[model samples]
Target: MYYIVMNMNCEDCGRYIPHSVYKYIGFCEEQGKVVFNEPPTNCDTVSKTTMDSLSSVFGSLGWVYCIDCKAPIFEMEEAVKHIASHHLITTRFMYDSVAAEEVGAVS
Candidate 1:
């Protein structure tokens, strides 16, 4: 589980992380530094792409996080199923938001 902290002190950070998320949320631990103020999105981490970037990522085994529940999606065959079952997820569309920021239409 992750935390959506909303307080000055990390130890004193308060607020619970919501289960359902539809939009992007920004969280930072740095006091006032610009770089630290805004955490990097998925795109920032994948700035450089290798020959097997997509292959390695898709081949890796793990539960893809859901946009709503961030749930453990096993076979989110249908988006509608996500509401009923929090275990369905589509790995390809997982990084849709940052797709445009990547090259070769691979993310």
Candidate 2:
């Protein structure tokens, strides 16, 4: 059975992990049809608020994490193209800055 875990916060980090889910592949002595009221351990770790927003936008497809904190954030947008674009731009800028610094050092 596949479970959609939501509306719960992680005990370890104070991130909002929402809509995090798990697919039960095997049967267990405990955890019957419905498990306890908690996010699945495999779910991304994120803030409760962020999880809520992600749940709203993504409508429960997959999971992700906060780029800055590395906390698993559920219900995040599916296509992270914007994030990737920003990351690429930032990396290029950094590389250019380093090259400029090296040139200046030689001069």
Model 1 residue pairs with clashes: 73-87, 76-89
Q: Alpha carbon lDDT of residue 104, candidate 1?
A: 81
Over 1-71, each residue of candidate 2 has an lDDT whose tens digit, in order, gives 21132443232122321122221121122333232324546555332333345444456545544333334
**Among all windows of ten consecutive residues in candidate 2, which has the lowest summed lDDT?**
87-96
lDDT of each: 0.31, 0.31
lDDT score of residue 66 within candidate 1: 54
The CA lDDT at 79 in model 2 is 27
lDDT of 2 at 2: 18
Per-residue lDDT of 102 in model 2: 48
The count of backbone overlaps in candidate 2 is: 7
Off by over 4 Å in 1: 1-22, 27-55, 76-107
- Model 2 alpha-carbon drift over 4 Å, by segment: 1-53, 75-107
- Listed in order, each prediction's TM-score against the native is 0.24, 0.17
Best by TM-score: 1
